[model samples]
Target chain A: MRRLCVHTITTKPLSLEECLVEFPKRGVSGITIWRQALEGRDLGAVARQTREAGLDVVSLCRGGFFPAATATGRQAAIDDNLKAIEQAHAIGAPLIVLVCGAVPGQPLVESRKQITDGIAAVLPAAEKAGVKLAIEPLHPMYADDRSAVNTMRQAHEICDALGSPKSVGIAVDVYHVWWDPELKEQIDHAGKTGRLHAFHICDWRTPTIDLLNDRGLMGEGCINIREISDWVDATGFTGHREVEIFSNRLWSGDQREFLEKIAASYAQLYA
Target chain B: MRRLCVHTITTKPLSLEECLVEFPKRGVSGITIWRQALEGRDLGAVARQTREAGLDVVSLCRGGFFPAATATGRQAAIDDNLKAIEQAHAIGAPLIVLVCGAVPGQPLVESRKQITDGIAAVLPAAEKAGVKLAIEPLHPMYADDRSAVNTMRQAHEICDALGSPKSVGIAVDVYHVWWDPELKEQIDHAGKTGRLHAFHICDWRTPTIDLLNDRGLMGEGCINIREISDWVDATGFTGHREVEIFSNRLWSGDQREFLEKIAASYAQLYA
Candidate 1:
């Protein structure tokens, strides 16, 4: 139960205040705050509140959209990521998961180059703030507009290009990487290189209706979550298994029940 | 115009007879027949009609759903594939494009083993019929049920496992592999090994609405069709560039207009 964490986006309907009150009640010991949840709130107070509520601030939800067409666009993305680093620092969060961006029609190779440069631009700020950045490789379906970093190998390549910075690592999300034939080998390598920063749990539904928001809950779909979880643990990763789902179906229901189901699912998954 | 081939599924509204009439009218030189399009029809008559209509029968649309949960299911799949081989032989199609298969929740490693074994079982029949088999690696998005083979590298690995048989080769589909980083290297290797048997073309729509039925036409989405075509051609692949799309949007429209557009798209793309 203490290792159970949930992203704010999982319970999309809950306000930050509501989340602080509700998450711990449902046995969620950690919370990864989405940037939207921090709007108009005092970061220090939110940090204090999270501590008082007996919940660890796991990490900031996202911070990378580094690839763009123009220099101005790239600079703007860097500025946003810099701001994210500061925000993570303010909120007492130690990490930020990156959903690196891609231009729809741009060559992916070019986009990846821009991503590498953009991360280089942001690394100094992240290092100063003592906040790590976890590059979460999106599924290939998002290779057009959402991300060009669509595999752990690509993420590792970027990390290598950046001189293997200590502040930069990867977040392994099963939804994006479970289909990879080289998943176990890549995960093992990431663990060895100290590049494995975070772990996320979700399932891939068979008849996935929507590409973006049709993620299945833990036991609701066909993913070998337990096996993947075992691999992550085998790497000596004693971190929280963040429940980060982007599901239209689950978000439309009662969030309280959703949280309840998440608690039960985590219990069964780890048991 | 000589290399422009279209799968019958691309224009789903057209019947086999209709395809025989409409394809040559639009300057399409070849046709790949989907098995469903030949349902309850005489294969010999269909072959005669296609040839007399001045269109080459490029390949049978599919055969290979090699993964199943049980021995009975696996044998059924193999039996069905054998039937597809006979149909291809009868129809004068020199090849069969395999979609392969995966069982939900089955380890992909296990599914891949089944696929390799199933292909091995059917290879003698395919060779005896003088029909080549092209392994079409489906996108990882379809890894749940469509195929465990999701990259050119994996397809090559399977071929290598089967003792690198001449009858078994790979079909390179841009839609399934455009995002792959190792695509160029894999294509180059396949060409050198004489395993680059077929090439497929289609665009990948940005906001892909449906997984199974929302493929984009050439120039309709973000895929670099020309670039991938260049790579295939660089491999000395003089095979027909099969236009294989599965779009509900195009299927619901006037297929004559769709064919006109396909012709225009191909001209603009290759020009």
Candidate 2:
């Protein structure tokens, strides 16, 4: 149906209660909440409030940060991700997005193996919990310190190695992948394998200020959001186009005004 | 033979004369001078100075930036590139690096086609002038404003389509391509196909402040420079490992101190 979702991370200053109340008012059909917002908050209340708002939980905002210098540290990450899967389940989210962690003062080759093994270890619990693990391949700039899984093909390779379509898939975020030469082909491949579980929307701004928090609004950057939307639509998987701009500029703005602007921009650039 | 080259852009504040004097003192064997530096300067004198210093002009700074909004604009770009190729020949550079221009307020798909056409339009002239056009695929972050070519695979595909090893090849830069999932495989592919023309070295800082000027010195950032150097070596590429940092911090330091630090870092991390 080409539904639109608002990722609450875009409005980092907003409370979960405020987000639940605001999304429907702005015509968003779904919400993708960050794990940081969920922490220490009442899960039952969050789940009940989200359901009461009649919003779809497209995805829970992340589960993987797998690399570690020690085995205990790595095991702790896996344990934490297991808990994150449970939270996703309780909140009725279909997918728990995994941002594969990067090397800790080590080479990329060694880190890549850690990421694959970490995902393999978590796949069993994810299947049992009935939560699809969505590998969100971050931009390559984050390949060292953030996510080692920096390409769609790499994410899909991990999924294939794990051998569980029901338990593993990928979240395609335009901000992270718009520069990829193999983007269209990879998206098409994901569609053929039914591995495209989520579609995230955000723009990559020129003269980008901050590597982590300077994501632009949809129409403000050079990304062809509508064209990407069309490609995702052609996949025949009618899911929400989740707005996930991690901008300090937007976070400092009025939450209601920001969501309104996002809705307006989405309609203008992507509708 | 393993050699060291100084990308004059790294010390852009210094004049070509200053660069020529510094190179031999710093134990550098080669230089890649920018077109702007050669624009008004006596290129014949500069070439003679390079030869007297026993310096190899590995590559000319650039020639590509071809996409334009009008036919005249496009033609002007081609003309500029022709002049650039002439300058490259005068300086005894084996390659004229090309940063394929981006879309002019258009979608990337359209911009990508323009880049292809632009390269094709200039190839014959470049070949006639005896200059190898090495496409430097910038990081995707620059895809919107700086360059449309963002991957080695994309650059190689362009070369393949153009069908001329004499006219087209790739300039592999670690700062741009270190994050690529297929980096190792693509480097191997590029080496095997003899499309590897130039290799530039730099590091990607974790909290990249400014998109254009915040590059880290080698070993200061997380890039596995040695591994990439090994890969480049395995390709039978005996070209210079040209240091091409764009750091505001380094640029602000004493030129001798900066060069010494770079030499020390190169020896410690990549030697």
Q: Per-residue CA lDDT of candidate 1, range A1-271, in tens?
A: 9999999999999999999999999999999999999999999999999999899999998988888889999999999999999999999999999999999899999999999999999999899999999999999999989899999999999999999998899999999999998899899989999999999999999889999999999998889999999999999999999999999999999999999999999999999
lDDT scores in order: 0.94, 0.84
Q: Give me candidate 1's TM-score against the actual structure.
A: 0.99
lDDT (Cα, tens digit) per residue for candidate 2, span B53-108: 87899899888888887889888888888888888888888798888888635666
**How well does model 1 score by local distance difference test?**
0.94
Q: RMSD (Cα, Å) of candidate 2?
A: 2.0
The count of backbone overlaps in candidate 2 is: 0
Error of 1 at B167 (Å): 0.6
- Native interface contacts kept by each candidate, as a fraction: 0.70, 0.44
- Please report the candidate that would top TM-score against the real structure: 1
Per-residue lDDT of model 1, residues B1-271, tens digit only: 9999999999988898999999999999999999999999999999899989999899997998899999999999999999999999999999999999999999999999999999999999999999999999999999999999999999999999999999999999999999999999999999999999889999999889888889999999999899989999998989898999999999999999999999999999999
